[model samples]
Target: KGCTWRTVSVDKIVTRDCHSKVFGDIVQATQPPACLDACGSQKTNTSSSCWVDCFYKAAAGPDSGKPGGKVAGMSFAELTAAWEHPFLPEDQGGCPPVKPKPPWFAHTTSVEQKM
Candidate 1:
């Protein structure tokens, strides 16, 4: 009953500590509000993928080099782009913000102010 409602595989997303500062900040900012909910049975693990999906939107591109710098091996633009495919939304998709939000979700502006 937690964010790990879906257990995290460190190798997949990489440990949070391994993220570059700029990338880390982006991950924190765009995290889906659904992520804070208590764990339960669900058809999909949108709680976690929702966040990774959001990250992919911004990080999957030829120019994604900046964030991938410290995270990935060498410069492999097209290959990297192919690897981080964007998650398409289906049945409301993984893109929409959750209603009422999960507990303690921070307002974007508030988070920006703190940054």
Candidate 2:
């Protein structure tokens, strides 16, 4: 017996239109990089423009100029050095603040007390 495979796509479907209730499990099933889990999302203006600018800046700073960037030229030693250096703001000290514990029967002496 012969076998054949066919590809199919739905034109109108998109992430925005996909309801959480319908695709919540599917969305949750996705496994992002471990680093993403460790590092929460950061806000940025002009996302696409920032990506291009970031690539350029990382190449050799602003003076490197437009179309002057080379991504592959970077060596592993340089990359490793950057990875070891702190990426977070100096004020944060590279660590998120500790969250206070929730009130519970054992932990809570008075839930009624308004802080």
Instruction: Tell me the tens digit of each residue's lDDT in model 1 across 1-115.
Output: 5554663532223222322333333333443435323323431243465444434434443244465434432235643432332222323222222233334655345756778
lDDT (Cα, 0-100) at 19 in candidate 2: 29
Which portions of model 2 miss their true places by more than 4 Å?
Answer: 1-46, 53-71, 87-115
Best by lDDT: 1
Tell me the tens digit of each residue's lDDT in model 2 across 1-115. Answer: 6998774732222232222222222222232334223333421222345433443344344445647544442355754444332323335322222344453775655757755
Per-prediction TM-score to the true structure, in the order listed: 0.20, 0.23
**TM-score, candidate number 1:** 0.20
Steric clashes per prediction: 4, 0
Give the C-alpha miss distance for residue 96 in model 1, angstroms: 35
